[model samples]
Target chain A: MARLPPSSGPASPAPAPVACSPHGRFGPYGGRYVPETLVEPLEELTAAWLAARSDLAFQAELSDLLANYAGRPTPLYFARRWTQQAGGARVYLKREDLLHTGAHKINNCLGQALLARRMGKQRLIAETGAGQHGVATATVAALLGLECVVYMGREDMARQALNVARMRLLGAEVRGVAAGSQTLKDAINEAMRDWVTDCQRSHYLLGSALGPHPYPAMVREFHACIGREARAQILQAEGRLPAEVIACVGGGSNAIGIFSGFLADAGVRLTGVEAGGRGPQLGEHAARFAGGSPGVLQGTFSYILQDAAGQIAATHSVSAGLDYAAIGPEHAALRDEGRAEYVACGDADALAACRFLATTEGIIPALESAHAVAEARRRAPRHGADAAIIVNISGRGDKDMEILSRELGLGGAADSPVD
Target chain B: MPSDSRAHSSSPAATPAAAGFAPFFARARAAGRPALIPYITAGDPTLEASRAIALALAEAGADIIELGIPFSDPVADGPVIQRASERALRQGVTLEHVLALAAEIRRRSPVGLLLFGYVNPFLRLGWGRFAQAAAAAGVQGVLATDLIPEEAAEYRQALAQRGLEPVFLAAPTSPDARLAAIAAASRGFLYAVSRTGVTGAREQVPPGARDLVARIRRHTTLPIALGFGLSTATQVEEVGRFADGAVVGTALVAAVHAAVQRDGPGAAAPAAAKFLRSLRG
Candidate 1:
């Protein structure tokens, strides 16, 4: 397993020299599967990433940005009310929601933007679903004064109108992809096409840990500070590692980020909650690990939802962020090695969890993060009261007001005066 | 899309070097002209119409006919070919359908056959099964667009065992070391991508293309087919200055597309033949 972050607490002591994903593989997964036109650029990226990983100057720059710009060391808070109510394990919340741009996505965006600048790239390109990544990319582009373009599906743009406005206001071009399924999968296709056409001048700042080599490893490293901080904080609070760490897996950036800290800790359980849209049938849900088999999509060899003819199957999810047909290649490797467990959180349960967290703790979790909350709610009461479970609240639900209002039928009702 | 194409697929293939591209290149060399290969998406507009287009391309002196197996997502293709693939896929074309088309076309003409696709569908059918099946259908070479030499050991072994060749693409960005590796892994002909972009028709062949071909020539004696932008006779003649063959993909695809749109599928074959002859003259 790749080592997490440098920590003051008892962590993996001094990781090996190599930091990238073994140059292009994670066991049987994560190969550089692309046209020869992209091979040279991927190689160049891999080399640059390798050089930057150990460069003290580069690390110092990223650390400074994370702290001063994106707001690093996102609090690992004890959820006293939720913990008392759960009546089982003490619950902790990794407050990535408090980060700038309102999500953990800023962690990755800042790092990749810096890398793009370092590489002398003239443009930054990305793909997004819930718009968190897009907003974060746009925010970083504004901060760095770089040209930015984000590919978002038409369906996603509809639900994420708030973020669409934010991106445009932040001076990034938002291209609405109208292709297959009109969601994250299609958005990714359009972004990759854009990158292929202008790879020399642009950097494909992939938002997840699911693309071709280096990216899966690179994005994870960028977000690894989440796990690193949580590990150190949890140790100070609970005096030991938590019994479980839960996060939602879309293309699996945040989950992989937080999981990186505890990957080597055999005592800590890693559970990835995927979006179970409505049912277990294909096209009804986006739970790849629950229903998918090994296949390649968007350049990674991972568990993917595909038809018998190898065409990618359509996926559904109430939370746009978790509505992808495949998981990250490393996540697949971790699943195969029994290092991490994956489960599905249906739309209803996740929605309920979102409201429950809001009412119980005054924290409105993003629908994507609510999947983890739903899983934690289920597993909390079952575990011992002394045991601790850290749930990664990946983002705030402020952007989800539109979808939430529509999904919960909270709209078209007469306004009530504040009591 | 069921057929009797696989009826003759059970018998394994003979040596691929003797069967398809080698003889075609030899013939073109004898004619003192660069080889012309025309590519079309099988089942575009309709599968039967694609058959006529392939036969027409063969009759128009195409050294090889490449049949693109439609996939749900084609990242390395430009808008024209992407739309063609979308049309083919809407008609429910799969690798098996393309193989069936190749088998039918094989029976009617001795022209070289190559199946172009991405890695997922090819691996979905399993390399062993796909190789046997493709070779059985008389396909000479297979070009999995995303399969690089580093990840193609199993694929090369599987295809070579079945007397089929693995065609690899060499890009302008490919360094000499990578070019040598790609050349060593390839069997029939090395695909020299003229530029660092998706397949499309361009106004003129970029000057970088000839340099790329020259670099690739340092690595292999195998015929290098210059691709990505030879849309006219001048362009094909321009390629003859450096490479042994010119691959026409998006340009011919556009011609067939317009023909089908203008006069229905019946006119696509004649239009394709006319387009190829125009490219040669």
Candidate 2:
């Protein structure tokens, strides 16, 4: 507790206004701005959540689920070689990749699934783009013996067919949405459609830290356990918290999860790395950081890359997961408050770091995570050798290897190339 | 039951819907026909055109106007509504503009306005602010196409506090108990989704929709409005026979789109009015 930084920023000429409000209002950003019909259920969730917060049983149960089912308390391993190359800044990796289902997604899914079960819901529904969240939801539905249906964009279903098959094999129904662009955006559209039509027995498990109201708050709470564990582990391992903590942002769940632990702390500098793609030019990147305005997309008010008329413009990124047009509401708030700094990493930078880590640290990160690793690698030289930096290794690179090999000219590397 | 007498309900202020409903609903109820609730995408082709379409719908015998605030992904909507949403979004219709249009309509039309939209926009605006603004804009009711009844507390509180009704959908897939739960909490009117899919004209309402409506009736005394696929007069009459109101959206929007394409903006609204009045007749 003493190690945590103070809530307000240290005295500065113009301290960035503390972004988040108690009721999830990040200066006019986050709010419970949903349809009137969903108000009661959101209230129930809030009530249940409030009760769950202090209930010893709920905490213990959540801990047990995290430890046994989700396989949490993920490691923070020292990246010796990567650090040596980084102008001597000691780098450590919080390995969320090694968690069950091979990404940090499962942590939130497990918690949400349990909450759904406790709520007496009989079924779970979700929308998936790259099919990562669909796979994660399917895994939980299988484990809990709950009915699950996932809506995936028809295009994404075709591109990420393997993930679709994996979800189906797990006994969850996968519906390929044939609407709009047939991508993640469309999948979310269809899922919301399903939720409106089938809200009685179903719970819509959102995949990211985006969405309106309870979702941003709820997903953050679930993922907060990640930060909680990491905080305790880091404190136990090192004399104090690291100087800077970094994570890749795609809907920003993993980054927020790690950052929430240090939100009140003024000393820790939180950095969220977005997929810069080809650069900041329109249609070239998905970095809402590099180019975004406060607008509504998905469900919440956040930084969205929209056209002049507030239309969702087409976004591009090497990673399907990070090719979104908006950032999470919390991240948008954090950016506004100056509590965090957002950086954009291009495809070249991420790929370079992916290769660098594979060669130097013997670890392969998801293309999304590689964005943070790339930034850390680039900035490590400036931080000095004694400075400690923490980068969240968000996922195992297995899902990305195929795409990376094809895109990056890695002809035949069963083992990804070293830097 | 007379039109003149209907203007003043015996105890309107005491009742929820009766309290807020005006002289328009009075005449509508006395006519012995269910209210025609026609939905149209605001700005399917253009904002001005959509505004004209709204007026045309009201003139065409629509008692309550369910103006659809188009979303990028309209989940509960079928192909036609999905297409309509796409067209509206392409034309740059936003939630802010949608509410502004409703405010504009309130300035001229006495027709009861109920906004039909996805939850994302309201969520984006923050429920409290959206509800207050919507109520101030003369929106009597809101039908969120995506919000579940169980998660409706904040939205419901905000809407109720603003004197706006938060309407919920009762579908064929819902169980008797779940229908009861939704009906008990719903206000203004229960949006009885005729089928499982999103909003669009269907060949027919599912055989179970009538039973679902009946089940909802048993739970609450609120009026029931049937929607999702009742485009033609035949379906409207069919739904009117049992429900208090019938909502026609996709078909009306389609007509407006067709009229706009054929005769341009000048004739679109009148054409829509003519087409919509045909549904009630």
Candidate 3:
């Protein structure tokens, strides 16, 4: 169990350091599985991250940027109506949607951008699926005055055209990848290839907690503020920790961020909601925990949806942000240890939750977050009315309005009124 | 795991050191010249046509023939090889098909065969099963493009158990410690990446490559084969001055692609043979 400091008392001594296996393995899940060409760069990144972690100046600068630039300490809202609608638990929503760039991705991008600058890298390259990370990366690049390039799958670019325009508007070049499934995985492949060629001058700002070492650990630490703030705020508001914490998992950045706060809290339950897509059939969903096996992809060993021959299988989800074939390595470790539980919500359930949140709470949740909302809706009714649940509303739905409009048959009116 | 011990542990009939490109390197050393190694995507235009192209290159002067097992996602490859892989995948080529093709090629030619591809397909087939099947198919060695030496202990053990060489790559950016580790782990020959980029052709070999080879030579006596961006004969000759072998992949693959477009798949063998001859000179 985690030792918590009293609200009125002086800060307690730091808790005992969590134990991890050498070489960044989370119970045999994560390792450096890249080519020889990338091993040195990964080592460089690992050393830089270790040095930065202890440097007070680096932490102070990052804190300053998070507060002044990306907007830190986003509010924690009490969802009275949502609680009443669920007819059980008292629900709270962590308002990460209020952050700059409209999602939690900026937290990581800003930290990596600062690291890149410190490393004397003049260029930044990233890969995105739903364009939220791309926009966040581009925004930080523009702020830092560094050259930026973002690779998006052609299929994703078509679905998220507004984000493409936003990236270009931010002075970042947007390249459309047309290989493989033409989705997040292919974009990752292209971006890695570019990094292998241009790593001398460029920093590959991985957007999630799913790649090789130092990235999963580094990105998690950058976003740990989300959990840290929420824990303190919730304790102040409710006088104790919530009964459960829930967040949607794609490559599992947001969930990992929130989970980090309560990982040692024995009283808090962690639930990760994955995109179930249409159903449970193969190629119909991105529910990695449901159908995936242990395999390696993009430099990390994790649960991956692959065919019998070990080729990565295609995955689908209405939420572009959650449409991936694998989850974070730590999540796999957490699941195995019974520390965290993973579940899935179908596309229809997610969309219904998105609509419900819009009409009831007047808050349009991103489709990715809607999966969490849907899971909360299902689980809340089973708990007592006094029980508390916190759902991480990871991003705003403005970027997803186009897809929602097309799906809901609202036509171009959805795009016309948003801007 | 010295070379002699590894040779002694495997099947008594199979000389593990002689089964791979070591003999070719020795022969080239005797001839006082660098060996020419050519790479081609298996089942590029078609599997049968790829077989003919491999034999023709070997007959023309290729000391070691590298048959690329086409993968859907090849991050280490540039546009040329990427397109070739896509074309081969479209032809429904699998690892099984590539192994079969290697078996047929071994029957017709004595040239050394190296099966090249990413790690997923091989992992799918199971490393033990894949290594056994590969050695039985007469494959001399295996170069998994994405499998680094650090995470390749089990893979190397399996290959060593089967008397098949486990080849590892060394990049210019590799530190001295890593170079020593790679040299100790790599069998057959050390694949020295000519530059810090994906496999493709360039006008001039990166100047850093020569220094990298010199650094690697201090670590191990294993013959080093320089690859990535060696397209022209002048570049090949320049590499010959310092390295034991020069690997030509993208240029020969481009020739095969051009031949298929111009005179059909039948012309690819002749075009590839002509290109190999020119590079050897």
Over 4 Å off in model 1, which ranges? A1-21, A415-419, B1-18
User: On lDDT, who's better, 2 or 3?
Assistant: 3
Query: Per-candidate TM vs. native?
Result: 0.95, 0.77, 0.93
Q: Of 1 and 3, which scores higher on TM-score?
A: 1
Order the candidates by TM-score, highest first — what do you get? 1, 3, 2
Q: After superposition, how far is residue A70 of candidate 3 from its true place, in Å?
A: 1.6
Report the Cα interface RMSD of each model, rounded to 1 decimal. 1.0, 5.5, 1.1
Model 3 per-residue lDDT tens digits across residues A1-419? 12222211112233223334558788988887777888888888877876776676777777777777777777788898988877988898998898899999999998899899888899999999999999999999999999999999999999888999999999999999989888999999999999999888999999999888878877888888888888987887788889999999999999999899899899899999999999998799999999898888888888989877677889999988999998999999999999999999999999899998998899999999999999999888887887888999999999888989878777744546654
DockQ of the candidate models in sequence: 0.66, 0.20, 0.66
Error of 3 at A267 (Å): 3.2
Please estimate how well model 2 matches the true structure, expressed as its whole-model Cα lDDT. Answer: 0.76
Worst 10 residues of 1 chain A by lDDT: A1-10
Best prediction by TM-score: 1
Candidate 1 chain B least-lDDT 10 residues: B1-10
Q: Give candidate 2 regions above 4 Å deviation.
A: A1-27, A54-61, A412-419, B1-21, B43-60, B63-69, B91-197, B201-229, B232-245, B254-278
